[model samples]
Target: MARSSTEAEYRGMAHAREIANNPVQHDRTKHVEVDRHVIKEKLDVKLVDIPLVKIQEQLADVLTQAVSASRFQDSLDKLGSGDIYAPT
Candidate 1:
C-alpha cells in the first residue's frame, strides 16, 4: 500500500530540508526533484519553518472555522434571509 498523504507531506518537507542543506547533485538525490516553487514561494513570502502543529490544534482550527461559518448561515436561515455561508 502507498503511504498516506500526510506521511508523504512529512517526507517531502524533510527531503526539502535536506536538499536545502546540501543542494549538491548526487547519485542518491539526482532522481529526486525538490519542489522549487514551494521553496521559492515560502522564501518570497518570508515563511521560515513549516510549522508542526499538533493534530488536535489543526483539527480545532478547522472545526472552529467550519462551525462558526455554519452557525452564521444557520442564523441567516432562521431569519429567512436565504444567505449562504460556506464552511471554511
Candidate 2:
C-alpha cells in the first residue's frame, strides 16, 4: 500500500532521487531549486513512483546497513533467499 507523505517529504525524496540518478552537478546553488520541479513533473506524469519504505523494513539494508544476524536473515528471506553467509 502506498502511504501518504507531506509535501516536504515528497520534495526531499524527489531531490535525493534526482541527485542519485544524475551524475552532473550544477556549479551555482540557485540551480538546485529546479531539481524539485523536474522530479515533481516526473511524478505527476507517472514516469516515476516513489513508494515509502520504512528504514527497518528496507530490504536493501541487508547489503547497505550494519544489520543484526536476525535482521539480515529476515531481509534475505524476504528476498526469497537463504542465509548462505549468515553469521555463525
**Alpha-carbon local distance difference test for all models:** 0.57, 0.73
RMSD of each: 10.9, 9.4
Candidate 2 lDDT over residue span 1-88, tens digit each: 1133355468777776777666664334446568878999999999999999888898976664468998998888899996566787
Against the true structure, candidate 2 has what lDDT?
Answer: 0.73
| Model 1 RMSD in angstroms | 10.9
Model 1: per-residue Cα lDDT at residue 78:
51
Q: Please name the candidate that would achieve the greatest TM-score relative to the true structure.
A: 2
Error of 2 at 29 (Å): 23
Which one wins on lDDT? 2
lDDT digits (tens) for residues 33-84 of candidate 1: 4565668688788895677875434433332344466565555555566535
